[model samples]
Target: MMNLAVFASGNGSNFEAVMEAVKSGAVQGEVKLLVCDKEQAFAIERAKNHGIPTFVASPKKYSSKEAYETNVLKQLHENNVELIVLAGYMRLIGSTLLHAFEHRILNIHPSLLPAFPGLDAIGQAFDAKVKVSGVTVHYVDAGMDTGPIIAQESIYIEDGDTREDVQRKIQQVEHQLYPATIQKVIEQITRGV
Candidate 1:
């Protein structure tokens, strides 16, 4: 089975979704490790609950970004991780991890991308009054959410929708689409497609 290491910095809702997908046999890999920069991040608890190994790489403890990422890299290497999934990992990936994983890193963003690239994307779409907002699963490049698109599923913004409403809708789509997209990517890699 392909080994995956998921990085998250916050609540880990997507992390939970991915774990559920693995449990239900919807995804064909093992989530060997959970990497978080925050010691108190709920993702850590989620990982523990699922019996997945957890690594906390606090940026404040490391002298530099490379140093922090090197620590993370050591964990990934030790786990034999074949794929890196960024599920709400707030920090930008440095060159060290980027070079190590290269095209193997994948990220799920809460926007159509190239439109609202950075954080608070759902809020950006809602504030901008966009009629359609969605999710994008893409390869993790050096830039923020500028990677090549792997899959995109759009959702319509209703006339009276609140920011929370839009966020909820987008998250629902993300939970389903991210795992399915990962499955497809893994299948293509295994098949040499």
Candidate 2:
């Protein structure tokens, strides 16, 4: 089985989803570790509940981004992680990690990508009043959400939809799509695709 390490820096809804999916064999992999950049992130708590080992650290405590990632890389190696899955990890991956993981990292974005790429993507689409907005699962690259797209599923924004409504829609899609995409990617990784 592929050993996986998941990174998150928020509420960890996606992290939980991935954990549940893997537990149910909907995804083929073992969650070897959970890496969180924030000590207070709910993802850490969720990881604890799931009995997943966690490495919680703040980049601010490290001297540089490379130093922080070097520490994270140590944990990844210790856990024998084969893939890095970014659930809600808010930080930009540094060169150290990018080089180490390369095509091994994958991320799920809250927008159609090439549309609203950065933070608060759901809000960006809602504010723009776009009739359609969706999720994008992609390979992680150095640029913000600029990786090659693996899959995208769109959702329509109704006339009276609130920002909260849009947020809920994007999250629902994320919870479903991210796990499914991870499963497909893991299969490809196993097949050397």
Candidate 3:
């Protein structure tokens, strides 16, 4: 089975969802490592609970983004990670990681990009008063959430819906869609095997 390394910077709800998918055999891959930029992130706790190995580092410790990415690459190589999943990973991926992983990296966005492509996407969609907003799973590139789209699922924003309401709906879709899409990508990656 292909090994996966998930990158997360926060609560890691999507990370937990992917773990559930793997546990249930919905995805044919192993979660070999959890990479987190923050030492205090709740994602580390989730990884610990699941017995998944974790690599945590601070950008402040590194001289530059490349330095941080290079260190991360070492951890990925050590774990033999074949796929990189960005689940609420806040850092903007630099050219170092972009070149290293290329199309092998995938990110889940909170909105149906290229609409709200950056932070607080759920709020952006709600503030824009868009009737429809959703989730996007896409290949990660140098640009911020501008990678080629792989999959998208829409959710409607009702007139009375709060921003939190929209956030919850988007997250619900993400928890379901990210794993399903990841499974498809894994199948293609290991198609010949």
Candidate 4:
């Protein structure tokens, strides 16, 4: 079975969705580990509940970002992680980890991509008076959210949609899209497609 190492930095709703999809056989893989940059991130507890190994390596603890990412990469290699999933992970990954994983890292961004590509994307859309905004799951490259698109689902922004409301809707799409994209990637890998 393919092994996934999920990284998260907050409530872990996306991480939970991935785990649920795996449990329901909607996603064909095993989450070997869940790593968080913050000790307070609840994803660690969620991983423990699902019997997955949990790790916390704060970037602030290291002298440089590369050093911090090195620690993360070491753990991922030790666990034989085949894929890395960034589920609400708040770090801007540097070249060190990108060189280690290359196209192996996947991130679900809260925008249709090529649009609002950074933090508080939902707020950006709301402030920009966008008509539609959704989710993007893609390969993680060197640039922040500047990777090859895997899949995108567009949801119409309502007339009075607040940032919170838009975020909730985007997150719903994220929960479904991330796992499905992972499955598709696995299928492509298996078939050499």
Best by lDDT: 1
C-alpha local distance difference test of each model: 0.94, 0.94, 0.94, 0.90
- Candidate 2, residues 36-133: lDDT per residue as tens digits? 98889999999999999999999999999999999999999999999999998998998999999989999999899899999999888988999999
Higher-TM-score candidate of 2 and 4: 2
Per-residue error at 162 for model 2, in Å? 0.6
Model 1 clash tally, residue pairs: 0
C-alpha root-mean-square deviation, each candidate: 0.8, 0.7, 1.2, 1.1
For residues 62-105, what per-residue lDDT tens digits would candidate 1 score against the true structure?
A: 89999999999999999999999999999999999999998899
- Give stretches of model 3 more than 4 Å off: none
lDDT of 4: 0.90
TM-score of each: 0.98, 0.98, 0.98, 0.96
Question: Can you list the residue pairs that collide in candidate 2?
Answer: none
lDDT of 3 at 41: 95
**Count of residue pairs whose backbone atoms collide, per candidate:** 0, 0, 0, 0
List, residue by residue over 1-193, the lDDT tens digit for candidate 4.
6899999999999999999999999889899999899999888889989999988987889999988888888899899998899999988879998888877899999998999998889888899999999999999987889999999999998897777888889988998989999989878877777
Candidate 2 — worst ten consecutive residues by lDDT sum?
A: 118-127
Higher-scoring candidate on lDDT, 1 or 3: 1
lDDT of 1 at 91: 93
TM-score of 2: 0.98
